[model samples]
Target: MTPSVKKIKLGVDVLIENDFDIIENKKILLLTNTTGRTSSGQLTVEEIQRSKKCEIIGLLTPEHGFFTTVPAGQSVNDDIIFGLKTYSLYGNSRKPDSKLLKSCDAVVVDIQDIGIRSYTYISTIFKTMQSCAENGIPVIILDRPNPLGGEIIDGNIVETGKDSFVGIAPISYIHGCTIGELAEMFNNERWLNPKNPDKSKCSLTVIKMVNWKRSMTYEETGLQWWPTSPHIPTVNAVRGAACLGIFGELGIINIGIGTTLPFQYVGAPDFKTEIINDDIKMLKLQGIHFNPTKFQPFYGMYNGKLCDGFFLTFTNDKNFAPYTSGILFFSSLIKYYPNMFDRGKLKQNSIDMFNKVTGSDAVLDALINKKSINDLRKICNKGLDNYRKLRQKYLLYD
Candidate 1:
């Protein structure tokens, strides 16, 4: 074994090895998906069930359902898993109803969060925590790696009153914290905002993973990577989603949703990569660079249309800055595709979505007003310093 490599144990392993005392003698409503598996590749549901330390009364799945066959932005349906009642948390309303809560004594969240704010897994857990708070039920979160490493906080905090299913919390776009750690912050920060002030905080127990350091990327943990969603098939895809996700929301450009390399590429039918490629390179996106390429998406925004863009090249994962490279890339795009960012050109709904994902309309305001790329970058990083300070205490790993 390499001396610098540290083998990490997941929270699921810690739960079992610790004898599952947290959920012992309780009826649990487990919130998990296909990604909720151990380092050894065993499903967390099966392991917890096999331990016989707690009675899993029901299963709660987030965006992609039990099998993760569901597509992005689509609602998942409730299904039966192992003869237990399974409820869908990605339906019309994300929170569980009173009847479902009545059936379980506690809520357990074991989903793998990729640490991006726009990703819906965190939102599901956030809403679940709210429900648990109001019902006086405790929530146990099986913590996992942040994937982007817990050291990198990117983008700006979602501004006040900009909360949505995607921007559900006032967190940075790439919040460098685990689901368990975020739960701690959520509870302490009183972001749950339950109907009753007294019930505003949920009792959250975080079963932390062993050997997980803030600076260690998911690959360094020496664990297998499971696609958090259909589009994020690999670690690089996750990075792509962080950097290029905004473009997807605008629908003005194709961000590789339909291709096998979803979120890994960006372009339009008339993007003219040659005109913009050199400028993008000049930005000197740290740890990453790109070369012009083209592809025809089978479906999605640019279905059956060939797009002109570049594929990402990462020289170093540790130094790869998703937010810096992403916002700067968008800034560069605005200069070339000025009309695309025009308020008149963009749909109001799409504009609203972009604002929600970014947590503010500052970027949109800057873009529409013909602001420089540096202006847009400043807007993107507006509250980053304060957010880092705010998130300091909630950090669970070094």
Candidate 2:
């Protein structure tokens, strides 16, 4: 479904309409991609260029390059895009070196995030913030509404320093905050520590949205959906990612990675949903139903292969909790087909990565140990109340 308000101005529009007063007359570097645009559909990079706002001396990008030149998980090399030097945070170095930090007076970040912990765009920004804090450079964040909205905080904080690239900040999987709010929390919470030792904070400027509410989903924000990555093409797809992404990292079943559905489809080749239909119902996620279906992927892991899985459908968005539901869904799968999670048959790196993405070994530990759903749920829900209160301090909108 598509919805448009057309009246809401994005941070880019607010930055431009005011004649770039935010960081005018400064040499700045932009960390953005095709997804960065004004409400009027002008590219943020182009708009910055058209105006004498600040000189965009260079560019940096996350997993997907400036124009999505390569697929996900592949390294992106430094190159020129739109006639400017572009650095790849997903390449040799995940953070900007001192040379690039010194080249620009400030760093402007305007990439869109999917609100899921492992999205990686947030990691690139987090890593950049660390470098900027150490180099004494300022970082500007352009706030965007979280696709999944901001009321539903799910998942656990990343363990002390586990798999930080994806789980960089100590927030839940479905962190309920705007990018700006999250940046504020990251700075305030001392997550900028492990790298800087002394925990230096970057000079931050979050140009907030004019009329955004924490309850407003991306569709309610009245903005068009821009593909954040090749996999995440629609806002509905964002929900799918939140529902199955961390579990998808297991890399066993095809969660529609190469298919048109991306994370929306949850089937594997030669598999049938009937095998575990009862287990899925045991998740107890009211209004959340999985309908069995089949598909052939266009590319990626399950390329041209017919996979059997169910698509997630929501009858009640208000009651849905992405990460909590994701865990239950995963738990149900292992409940019936425990062999699917066998580390002996699975890649060790995949299990290691799953633990990393999960911020702890809790999920895998519980699954391997054959713990009950309630047992795993209690373990996962351990620190949620603490997180809810912690997040309240950084929320910018109601």
Candidate 3:
């Protein structure tokens, strides 16, 4: 029999070790959610509550609320839960006010990120850092593995001036860096000075993960999976959504809130599965295959109607580049179904949101102009180069 490998400790471990030293006699605020857990499935909030030297002052939550109960696009408000005043950072106001930061000496952030640009959790981290910087508070980040791994880069780079809650900055769709590494990049390269306008003020410290490699996926880490958002129910959903998410720009709605496969299926009463399946084959995407099938979503787009489409299945995660997979899927859909693929018919919100998530207008333009997937590949590569240069300055791993 083969011996089981041991799971490595994440950034939370490092943060706990240094918690007494850094947070001694100080009031600390924790920015986290229900998914923020230690190797043994212990919550960060529970750990901090029992700490001897640290006083946990409050909680700051991102989209989906602290427990991750709220669905996507829903705003959360301030409430008291687990005996602490929890502030909704994902509410109508995305940033923490000065009043919220006034009582905290330092803020500890520990959120699991899905290695995608539009996930919104990373932007919450950025906003928290900005708040702490302005108020002269320090931020300590408990880093975790980028579940999609750290070596692969995909999709087009987000263009400047299109920053939103989804795509917060100019980064590749599947940014290969962890949340901590991204914070470092945003501060150093992007010049996000949290404290003084004339001087960089946000003091940041990252608790690095142990035995985590750039090439390993979440399964390799031996960590239990938790849905970072409501739609991404499984690891496969993460992989498939990264590809199918491209169709979001085309106004093809996934089974709305009620369906099990949120971003995995696309449906319209008039939709044909054969067209999408053929496009998938033409792209020659590796490590995955698509199966054309029919589904009737309980709610959301094309509800109560049998919709035709395929669910993406990955044969090998190692070779799957989700960002490329997504672009190829969208580009192929545009090429084959020119009549059904109406560039003008797509909602303005969809175009803006997709562009924001993708980080540029080039993708929409390419699909509209019937540009080759090769053009998207080139754009993806350019974004990768830029990200690589910026990411090196913040890496804490060997």
Candidate 4:
């Protein structure tokens, strides 16, 4: 099947068109990675280099480094790429230090986000915004679409105590907002304010996407999919990962690092695919199907052992809610095989991580107690109601 071609006017595109007008003759520092590409597959670094009004003084990279050459969880050191001084925001420092931000007049951020609460890119953006605000530097965010679509919000509300790189604030698992919209929320919520510091110090602007709607999925927007991270290789992977990542909290890493479909496949040698299938059938999630299979991962968990499992396939993008779907699957897994699943192996407490991603611990605890979907829905609704009111204040696009 031929993939549909739809032209998306990304936030970077809008920034480029108005570069000469809004930022003429300014020394610009850009925060981007491999996913920050033009509609025609041109890198944002190259585009900024070619712009007449902007001087590309430096490049700032988050988690995966400039070309996404680094492995997950590794720190990136300072390096030279394309003859420019590149700073690693994901390494020793998550935010640009005064030394790095000193050379530029303004900072421009253009990166794609997968919309999951646990993705560190958005947190990186938030920290950068705080740094820029502290140093009295103006920050411009080139907003992109939340590839998972923005109509549906799911999961629990993150609590204050469990904040981490994956989730630094109180938001839903599938936050229905763009990067720009999120920055606005951070600014208004005063989330970046340091202790004993003046609160009125941040300056930020978000260049919103043109012709993008809240209901449009990545496929609907006609934008090409660039793997935001090495593991998230395709839209299907992102959708599946959104659901399967909950397993990580249960100490169930999917297939190894080398596999093409990493998070989509779930199994261990002891896993009973029949049980999983039965639970999934009982739950009756919309827009997805599971196919039973067996495989040996080259690395990571259950390495080099034949493991039985199922691969998730999405039938409709519009009706999918990865976060909620994941919780349901996880609850079922825990219920059916309480002894096999170990929740202690999670980096933070699994309960805490679940609360962080879902936004609250009550729902997960309720699930642990085998709460009905209707009862769970009520718990989720509280967070959604709070998020709706809080989110309304920061929406940049209609």
User: What digit string (tens of lDDT, one per residue) describes model 2 on residues 161-204?
Assistant: 57568778677878878788888887877778655666468889
Give the alpha carbon lDDT tens digit for every residue of 1-398 in model 4: 12453456888788777764566789988899889987667888888787767788888999878776677668988889889889889888899998778888999888988888788899999888888878888988888888777776776667667677787778887788899888888887788765626643478888888878786767777778888877887887778877777556546546334466877787778777887788789887877777788878877777787888777778655657677776677667776577434435344566666565555567656765677776755665566678877888877665
* Top-lDDT structure, candidate number: 1
Comparing 2 and 3 on lDDT, the stronger one: 2
Q: Predictions ranked by lDDT, top down?
A: 1, 2, 4, 3
How big is the positional error of residue 393 in model 2, measured in Å on the Cα after superposition? Answer: 0.3
Q: Write the per-residue lDDT of candidate 1 for residues 81-176, one digit (tens) a residue.
A: 978778898987799877788778899888888889999999999999998888888898998998888888878888888889899888889889
Residue 153 error, candidate 2, Å: 0.9
**TM per model?**
0.95, 0.93, 0.91, 0.89
Alpha-carbon deviation at 225 in model 1, angstroms: 1.3
**Candidate 4, RMSD to the unseen true structure:** 2.9
Error of 3 at 275 (Å): 5.3
Which pairs clash (backbone N, Cα, C closer than 3 Å) in model 3?
133-194, 158-359, 159-359
Looking at candidate 2, the ten consecutive residues that score lowest on lDDT are: 1-10
Please rank every candidate by TM-score, starting with the best.
1, 2, 3, 4
Q: Put down candidate 3 lDDT per residue, 196-279, tens digits, no spaces.
A: 574454888888888887877677777888887777767777776677665655565553234677666655566556766766
Which stretches of candidate 4 lie above 4 Å from their native place?
Answer: 1-6, 194-197, 253-258, 317-319, 341-382
Full-model lDDT, candidate 2: 0.81
Candidate 1 ranges with C-alpha deviation above 4 Å? 1-3, 317-319
